[model samples]
Target: MPGIRFSAQDLAATRFTCSRLREVVAGVQVLKDAGARAIHLPWVRQARAALAGVRYELLSQLVPMPARYLPDFLSPMPAATAPSLAAELAALTATAPAAVRAQLERLPRPLPALVADLRRDPAAGLGRLAGEIQAFWTAAVEPHWPRIEHLIDGEILYRARRMATGGPAALFDGLHPKVSWQDDRLTIAQRRRTADLVLEAGRGLVLVPSVFIWPGAAFEADDSRHQPGLVYPPRGVATLWEQGAAAPPQALAALLGRGRAQLLAELAAPASTSELAARTGQSAPNVAHHLAVLRAAGLLARHRTGRTVLYVRTAVAQALVEGGG
Candidate 1:
């Protein structure tokens, strides 16, 4: 029952951002925990194949299957809204040795030797930890990084619009069933502890949408934080690896054609041309052409975030995609 008691200052400071590091850590966690596999079965199987022989024993042990608590340092809150792997890894590498040891010492142990070594020499241990994560990313994450990034970006965009139109409730309510915002406070349900910790004067908050953190959510707030963060699974993880296009209502497809219908079917969660291309096995130019036509027909709404322009179904498009037509 841990919660963040937000002040006016905390609410003003809150913003949306996504992380690559979190997904990397979550991917490792999925591999370590057997029961957690069902949440992202497609990803777990694909990652298991990709991570073959990857030296993540230390990383996996640290985030054991049925985790009690994962050390905060692994999922560092990046200063940037959308941080690259290098930036996240650098943040991990720069952790203060004392902070690292304190978290490790608190772990339920007889610690693994590597973890013990890490607790003994945090600076050196940090280097090894970063090395393993970087290796894991290179092997399992890099190939799918674009699709993951786009999905998280689209989630932020959808939530941003929801907050703008419907205020905080619309934004927080969709995050996870266990996460809820009332008054100015945000409460996170924990599996074990029943006590809630309130932060009266938080610097800011980051909501990190993860492709791997499905079926659960995690949040943190402490004096050490410049910003508190909640990492929740993004909304459309089920479609991340899915290839079957949504069956557009027959009438809609008849009007829009099979190609554009397929494109429309896939945009339930906004995506860029490149992301759609990858998702549908189409060329980027082909996706772009279809998106242009969809926009012209008033069936899609385009919104730009950073350098990417995402397309989501307009109300009309939504009805059609749902077979209203």
Candidate 2:
């Protein structure tokens, strides 16, 4: 149980954003745990096969099962609200050896050979780790990044909307069962809490909503160099890998072609072209073509969340789906 005292300046600086690399990291956490398999079965089946050929011996050792404390270098606070995986990887590889050694020594050992190697020659080891992560990114995360990005962006927007009317209390309230905010202090229910970052100026709390780390939350803190962040599961975790919605109404399908109508029906939540393709069993080109046509017809609207574009149903499309007009 640790309380983060946030001064007025800190509150002003607090921002909500999503991380692509964080999702990749969290996916690893999910893949390693058996208990998470049932809810994430769709992804588990796919991710396991994709990851089988990747060289991640060191990467796996860095984030051990029952992950407690991970090296901050694994996911440094992204300078960009939406950093490309390459950028995040560069940051990881650039981690000061002193910092790498410090974090690794803290982990309970016997350290795996790869992890121990990182401490000995961090520059070389991290390069290999980054390469492993890149291979992993291609297999497990890149395929679903659009959907993951959409989900994270939507959650941030939802929290922003809540804060607008309900105030900060609402923004954090029920964010996670283990988190609470009051008296200009944000509290995280974690085993260890340090307040060094709280006293620093201009470094606000960074909020990151994640998908694979559902049922738990992670808090990160360090000196001014690293931004303090909290990574928690987003609200729509259950639907991330869900198949398409049920059949679109026949009347709507007649008005709009069957393919387009089906796409519209599955978009009660905003989604990317890739996401729609995965859920609906359509090709990327086909889904992209349909989304463009739908946007022109005013049945859908697009919003850019970081690097990904999300298409949500417009008012007209909503009425059409609900049998209104």
Candidate 3:
């Protein structure tokens, strides 16, 4: 079979790299050389799991890490392309379950419109909004903590880059990647392992399914969006398991301290600095000071709404909340 032609829509549709298209072609040859019969694409894996009627846990190991390497191809697009859950729920309500539909109704309505605005105008400054929605989902899923962790670990196994230089722990610690369970398959979307913006997973042609390919890279929807997507060929595979050996108690404390706890509790709903202050019972200025500190820590972020700055916890922050570490 001939290779698929590339286009801008393809670039935006998926999340992996196209610059190394030749490498992908070569990798496919290597896969065929290895005597593997039918190759399982990323989406196929996901669909298989969904058909099982249970969400299969992907690479959960990587979920604890921060999103260190985001694709630079479309940095200007919103971090999340899909409109807010509220918006998607409204669209899917007719067919969605009552429980799921109710969950969607709980979200703020304007969130999706704001996301669209950010997508259409890069300078709209919706990063904070993105952070808030992400936080909300993180917090909302606490009841399903075990399942989420399993999904992340599954994603790690599916997408974690197999490094020749170090073991899984070292590579995981060093890279600090994000893993997710999409369509019931675990997925690891590549991020900058370092400042170079090199596609770490793509470089080795490992079994790491390129988010850039099939389902495309699932970024926060900031830029790098295209359709008909690009894919990275598989090579070696690394497993993402739960962080087996626990870190020291102090380390855990630092991760889920008073500040993070307070922030997570408040971010259940998007709130401005003043609103957060009111909720925390702290003076507005004092609340503002802490908000700034949290944002710098990447635990909380800010968004502009009208004349005020809305603050919310980040996914990492919620991870700490969920992990209690």
Candidate 4:
């Protein structure tokens, strides 16, 4: 199992971030899966149809197999709080020719001619690659980004609460079955081989929660050039692709009006008014009215991020949903 040995300094410097670039990179893998493991994601099905006209063959060739170790230049550590896709694509375009060749040389198998061309003229090659990525995002990701962002934000909030209440160890808890934290060492169970990394001052672990990298976790700590980080799937991902609102329990539906009760039940995971309306087949105005009523009653809480307002069940509401109230 590969383990990251955090010195006292490293532990103190560890931090968490929700990276846009990382998500884009991981999303490519999800597309490559072709709904095999991500059977639950109905969005993937739609995305595939949307992307049917794009140059998917070339894009998939660049990503290759063993999707974990993608070229670092393509998805560098995000620099801003919320990096725009343009910014991430620019980073890919900026890769030096030599660096691109170096990464290609490290691939386990012989490089395809298209990829080898990257070594000859990195700027042109990377530009083409960036265009492919943009096309993919526009076709497969942009339309679904709001729902995806909501899920990511909810995970971040959940982790923040875990850290606040239980400290560092709590942060590692339930991250993945293969990951464990003990005696200041963050261990990741790996099949290939064993390795250890000691973080120096100013070099901290970046914890990134991923929606696409499901059923397993990945650790990358050996690269001295980049900040070490772990990419693990966020909780509640199984419900990510669920198509429509489930029927509320009969008793609960009878107690609260069916509309409000259905909204409450769906609030088990955070969702915006638009998302709720889309899921429930209700108009946005109607959804907002129900949400406001629930919020006034202390059954739900509203969180504003950017221009979007997300609603989640409060403990009182959760109890009600669970049939306790």
- The C-alpha local distance difference test score for the whole of candidate 4 amounts to 0.76
- For all candidates, the clash counts are 1, 0, 44, 0
lDDT tens string, model 3, 1-325?
1122223333223232222212222222322232331233332333333334332121111111222322222122212322334443223222223332333333344435433343344332233333333343333332333332332232333232322243333222322234332221223444422221223222221122332222123322212231222222221111111112223234444655554356455553345665455445667787677777778889875655336555555667767655663
Error of 4 at 238 (Å): 2.3
Q: Model 1, 70: alpha-carbon shift in Å?
A: 1.1
Question: Candidate 1, residue 72: CA error in Å?
Answer: 1.7
* Model 2 agreement with the true structure over 146-203: per-residue lDDT tens digits: 6777887777766776787787788999899889988777888787765423546667
* lDDT per residue as tens, model 4, 32-73: 675565653676678778988788454566676466466777
Can you give the lDDT of residue 154 in candidate 2? 71
| All candidates in order of TM-score, best leading | 1, 4, 2, 3
Model 2 residue 44 lDDT score:
87
* Model 1 residue pairs with clashes: 33-65
Candidates' C-alpha lDDT: 0.80, 0.81, 0.35, 0.76
Report the Cα RMSD per candidate: 2.5, 4.8, 19.4, 2.9
**What TM-score does model 1 achieve against the real structure?**
0.89
How many backbone overlaps does candidate 2 show?
Answer: 0
The best candidate by lDDT is: 2
> TM-score for every candidate vs. truth?
0.89, 0.79, 0.24, 0.86
| Pairs that collide, model 2 | none
